[model samples]
Target: MDDPRDPRRDATSETAGNDDFGNEGLTSSDTLELEFREALNLANWTSGNRLQELGERLEREVELAARHESEMAPRVLDILRRNLASAEGASVESGVFQLKPEIVLNALRNVLFNGLVEASDGTRVTVATLPVTVVQIGVCLTSYSGDGDGGSIGHRLFRHDIMRRNSAAEQDVIDFLGRRRRRGMDTSAYGDDDQPMGISDMLCRALMIYGERAMLLERSERPWRLGHGGPMPHELIVGSGRKEMAFASLEMLRKLLLDHKRFIFVPSEISDQTVVTIANSLQPLQYAVLRDTTDIIENYVQGSSYERPHYKRSGLYQAVRSFQVDAGSKVLLCVYRASAIAPGRVFYAHEDHVHEAAQIVIADAALQESRGFPNLIDIADRTCRGMFEPGGLSAQVHATLARSGSPFRFLEERRTRP
Candidate 1:
């Protein structure tokens, strides 16, 4: 793990001129500007009258967009509202409908917060010539249950670990991954290839796998605090992204759907395909009556069987598939807008509590009208960052290196930069 950075390489690159890269004789600046203007004129001449036609087309597009926002959106909401009612009735008749908690005293008790890393790829190279790659991670899990007073009572579980690649620590991770694989968990995402990998690339994958394991263990603390004598939470609220809650092993996802039964994954960001579907499905609504209000579209199927090949490879698809298979009618995908102020969000719920999840998100978002994002997720994220300030962690690592008689001059040049 020698220092990958070499000052000689930068010096060589800086000394090399344009001619070294096979460039033709450089033209004068005036000639270059004249050539650019001539090319622009040629392009304009080639376009001819088509530019006017393009302008007219753009005008039509603007008109269509205006119609979509002012007219189509409201009508689409009405149809979605009707469909939601139908779904609710079907769920009730099927004996799967469950009401939201009346008090919601323990609803916000569970939250998953991501770890923070300062260096590129979660790995920092120490020493000047003979460098080693080390990864530092700090993760936290919070449970904020209601107290007797108006305020809330909360507790945080914290863990920190550092590992150097190809060392005993790395071997421990490899063995841990192997054990998880033996237990029917999918570790293919964290697999190694025959080709040589950089320290950053290797550490990136290792960090994700290790960080997820750390998060899972942290979330399983204290049974009494999680309600009903269970180590895991009944309802776990996580942010929307592949790395957030969707990066778990396939077996772990199935266990979450089947065992926990209430893993509420609210993705604040919607997909492009979903956006296109929403736009096309509501195109005809331009002729209908318009209203200004928030609405929900229930049971929105994300991708189709036609695109299974592309989507099946994604972790999100695996998570959604697990919910569909193990959670059955308990699963729901609700697309709802808090208001016209923001776009719609998807709630990938696994307990037939789509409306309730939407309500909680909306209510929490209302409290932070500035961003209109979920306050619970935001607060948890902020808490994690605050607890694990990257500067402090980096300083601690450097201090330990100094104490071990590692020459400060051997440190990477980038680490010494202001």
Candidate 2:
């Protein structure tokens, strides 16, 4: 929804400025990194624009490695190569795949991306060395924090790669689901070309809806103001203090929402009975569930991956579309899962105790504010890019904390204490 200068214009200006320098001027790693960063910027910024052409522009950025960035050639290609491979991989499990920049960076450095992921069906797989340019397709496909100031939601959404739809991945999904159907798993949606359902798909639709909603706002210009709602299991809602819970951005949003704390976004990961359980549990907090509005929003947006076909009855999209925020909540909104998919429930808690599991939540506002909140890891990766490369923020909070200017120097430490 952000309309800054056209990327075409930026590229034109850069190209024009480059005509005189020829191939020799771009040699320094500093220059290569800056340009690569710009390309990365453009890649994320391509949302809401002509996606295909913008994609070419992104590839052109990788191509910019020539001239004098020859040393960075492998790394640049690795970024692009990994992107395609991951796209293919995402198709096999979930109909979509999304990753944050930190995930990609780690994948690049790993001995083949092995330690992080664990799927819903108990499947585990590591990405194994991939590109820096994985599937950034569409708004919901983005990471927790973005490249803008303070890592606000708008900045994250804008700079994250959220492709509208991916035909290839969709095909991969259909093929996988077909195999499932053959095994009698009730893969009904595959009866059509594609279903616009999935965490990423619905999230994209929600954002587009918000954009439309933003325009219709008779009150504030702020689209992020709407409250949120959804179901949650007792362990996560209350706490287990022992077992790690599975959630998308729910808890992170809770801790980060200092003001917007009253809202939550729910996906199709939980059951309907559980939703009712969560709703009942919220009675003490004076919260109530609103009838779903999924049908209303469904008419407005479609699947966001680049080339995937869209169908009418995607379950995941409906879950998000049905989400309603309690405008009357005192200070917090809850987002839990509701499943017509599964017919069951579970609940329990510990506000003082946490699962000791590390979760990374992508959020707006200051990711910095989430420093010590349990169950959440604030990934302000891009924000600290310079510290690692002599290019990120020169004065990161951690750096300042580690430096010392005290008058006394410790004999063993050999420096003034911070």
Q: Using Cα atoms with residue i matched to residue i, what is each candidate's TM-score against the true structure?
A: 0.46, 0.16
- For candidate 2, lDDT tens digit of each residue in 1-418? 1111121011111111133334555666878787678877655565665679878887876776444343332333333324523532121111111223343233323311221211000001111111111111111111222322221222112211122446788776676555434433322212233442222223333333332222112222221222112222222221121111112222332332333222223222334553344332221101121222222223223443211222123232332232213111222222211122221111111111101000111112112232211111112222222222331222232243346442223122433346
In the range 295-386, model 1's lDDT, one tens digit per residue, is: 12113224333136544564445555444444455444434334334444444443343434433444444445444555555554555556
Model 2: residue 166 alpha-carbon error in angstroms:
35
Cα lDDT computed for each candidate against the true fold? 0.37, 0.26
In candidate 2 the C-alpha lDDT for residue 202 amounts to 32
Q: Which residue runs does candidate 2 get wrong by more than 4 Å?
A: 1-133, 140-256, 262-269, 272-274, 277-418
Give the Å shift of residue 301 in candidate 1: 18
Maximum-lDDT candidate = 1
Instruction: Provide the lDDT at 2 for model 1.
Output: 17
